[model samples]
Target: MTKSSGADPRKTDVKVSLIGGHRLAGATLHERTVTASLIGGADIDLTDVGIPDGAELRITKLSLIGGVSLRVPRNVRVDVRGLRLGGVKDDGPSEPGGPTVRIDAWGLVGGVSIRRA
Candidate 1:
């Protein structure tokens, strides 16, 4: 599907991928919305999401079988809720309050981890 998200990178999709990653350290999503959908059996890694002030990033879907690892900049505000049929979810460091990163995660046999970068 195509979108007119305007300058912002459109929805990111990784299907049957062996590896996947995304960085947003010095990037701009200002006034833009970014969403990522991870579906399949690949292990995905997202780094520095919404760091140093960015836009609203929503992980609308995550149904990967290999799981996902999200490394966010410490002190950023994060809202995450993961449901696992059989796995675990790790919380990162204390949130000092910064940018916002929202996520709705789910897994069958995989897990999700939030690490402080």
Candidate 2:
């Protein structure tokens, strides 16, 4: 329900708080150079959201109903924990070299795909 961003250039952090069963689609975060967190079960659609190099994206304690896709750059790290990818479509590359994507979806049922361009 709340979203906050840091002001300092050295601190590039974006925090998103979502309630359970909420639907979030077409959300994009760009150019920031820090970490992102999405908490709770929400339908999130992250298509064409460019994550910068060396940035960290963390999705924890949530169930992704609609799922999330990343057009991520090289050297970025993504961590997903307790996430459920339902009705997800993989439209990117299968190789895992652009970013160090770490997924810990213990309750995932759908599917997750990563592509490089």
Candidate 3:
């Protein structure tokens, strides 16, 4: 995927955006709530994901234009079967079920994956 010309996405300066060939990766995410958007050949590498005891972390939307590789914790579950036109969604490591990761994806012509961490 093409890298974004923007600033460091990991910085707080970037609120909620991962596009224009950008990239974002969170080392240890503990926020109970979260949102993400990807497009224009961008990439969001969420290495480690987390959530509260009985809460949920929602990835509002992941409109991939290039690709996305997210490594979720063994605790939380991934359900990124939101919306699609013509592309692919790979919620890697088929766990039984856990916390819901409601992902509204739009892989018009790109790739998306949620692997184990």
* Per-prediction TM-score: 0.53, 0.36, 0.53
- Candidate 2 stretches with Cα past 4 Å from truth are 1-20, 26-41, 63-93, 100-117
**lDDT tens per residue, model 3, 1-115:** 1222356433222235665554545442323223444655334454444444455544444455544455667666666655555444454554555555554555566555666
Task: Give lDDT tens digits, candidate 1, residues 1-117.
Answer: 123366655545332333443333324333222333344432323353434454445553345454555566676565766675544455655565566666555656555566766
Estimate the Cα RMSD of every predicted model relative to the unseen true structure: 5.9, 7.1, 8.2
Better of 2 and 3 by lDDT: 3
Alpha-carbon deviation at 101 in model 1, angstroms: 1.4
Better of 2 and 3 by TM-score: 3
Candidate-wise lDDT, in order: 0.48, 0.39, 0.49
The positional error of residue 13 in candidate 1, measured at the CA in angstroms, is: 6.0
Ten-residue region with minimum lDDT total, candidate 3 = 26-35
> What local lDDT score does residue 1 receive in model 1, on the 0 to 100 scale?
15
lDDT for position 85 in model 1: 58
